[model samples]
Target: MKRRNSIWMIILVVLMTISLIGCGTTQSNLENKEAPKPTDKVTIGFSISTLNNPFFVTLKEGAEKAATEAGAELLVVDARDNTAKQISDIEDLIQKKVSVILINPTDSAAVVSAVESANKANIPVITVDRASNGGTVVSHIASDNVKGGSMAADYILKTLGNKGNLVELQGIAGTSAARDRGQGFHNVVDGKDGVKVVASQPADFDRAKGLKVMENILQGNKDIKAVFAHNDEMALGALSAIQAAGKSDIMVVGFDATDDAVKAVKEGKMAATVAQKPDLIGKTSLETALKVANGEKVDSSIPVELELVTK
Candidate 1:
């Protein structure tokens, strides 16, 4: 609003800050009024289950970068892993007239009604890293979790020499990742004669629970040779429990190439971890959301490739 020598221009990015990149107009050459025109605040909603986990944190970073570059406002709400809260957050975003909605759901089935409500408000919805069993979300971007699970299984087989007792540390009990990863591991281990799953327990994707569950499993069966954890946090926690128990016979493998998991892999503490590339997942989701919001055709699902990192 103030045209001082420093040039103070007002841009109303309501919910979040926007960084404008002047590509078509040269700010140095054109007159102040004719130079880079500011874009109106186009608030896009992001409903994240929680900001506590590293994966979700990285996803938020990527989404923020994309939103800033596009001169769009980002309104992020935390559900704190509650389905009801997630639904309310979406409803609030819709009431605020956010241009689009990006949901990293707390529960696939529970979020269906919220997505439907957003749709009724003429707001496009996009799912990131998880899918709803119902509702018409415009686009979905998530890692090929089943394939990542297979990769971990392959690592376990190779590490255990294809014939050893194993344990599975599941993520959040009902999440898609936990189910798919379990299926992938079982498919491989069930076929092998001596490679039996001695224990399979749910850790709820938390390091503390992983430690506790692993501790219990260790007391019951000390002969386990390898463990496949559905997520990096769980795997790392299991690794710590193994160390605390003074056991060196267990081979630990984790999905999600989180920093801790990578360190463990490098130190030979964990056999391998799958790299999901959360930054890419976030960027792709927003770009896809933009397309869907503009009435352009976008794929229902874009699968993220997985990479195995092991030493």
Candidate 2:
């Protein structure tokens, strides 16, 4: 009876060991299932509004550099500033099942449906240099355009000595950057009793349009003392018109200190321009997208710093 009991006890110990080994395997599998490995491949999609502008070109380059550093694949599609094209590009990226998407919207309100499509696909979306009107976005990365606008206005005020007739050149009508910048400029300029806005028109952020608009405004308003363009392109266009008209006394303030704009500032052609870090915005957007892909939490609004560039 004692020998039989000893044999049974040994068998019982073997059974317990096997049971523990099975439990260990199950727990290991569960842990592996719960977490993704860091080495998992990541693919990011970029939908640019237009590469025609040098600013956007720089932004794309920055995103590409960041993607290369992270060992991630970047698929860039240019909308050429077409809202429909942008929406279609986003849908394509969704069908490609990219890990994340970065969009620079051509029109703030028009891109809502496209953004929603990305949401439905469970792909994270980040906006660079612009924002979408309605959609679930992980984060928005851009300069504080309103503040930059105010900065331009303040500079104009100081340059004009608190009293002048000003002309406002607007950007694309539906864009948030255009709206916010115009608001900021008006916020300060409107309240001043001495300064008056002679003419405000949308140049669609185009240099040629800015020139033509300024020429028309000049034809009607000869007393205009200064011009504030929503962007450097328009500002440069306005500058050309002013120069051709032999109006050397007019002060021009612009936003987005692009290379040409900065050169103009240095050469005393333009009064000042609000500097936006387009490269940083692009870099941050890609980095943030990677974090979101990794299931990390991020702020809904991310603002890049702005500076007033002057000669």
Candidate 1 lDDT score relative to the true structure: 0.84
> At residue 36, what lDDT does model 1 achieve?
62
> What's the TM for model 2?
0.87
Give the per-residue lDDT digits (tens) of candidate 2, residues 1-311.
99999999999999999999999999999987867557677999999999888788888998899999999899999999899999999999999999999999999999999999999988989988888999998899999889988999999999889998999999998899999999999999996889999899999888999999999999999898899999999999999999999998999999888899999999999999999978888899899999999999999999999999998
TM-score of each: 0.85, 0.87
Considering only N, C-alpha and C atoms within 3 Å, which residue pairs clash in candidate 1? none
Expressed as tens digits, the lDDT of each residue in 121-210 for candidate 1 is: 889888888787788877788998878888888888876778888999988755666777888778777878778889989998888999
For all candidates in order, the CA lDDT equals 0.84, 0.93
lDDT of 1 at 111: 88
Q: After superposition, how far is residue 11 of candidate 1 from its true place, in Å?
A: 50
Scored against the true structure, residue 185 in model 1 reaches a CA lDDT of 76
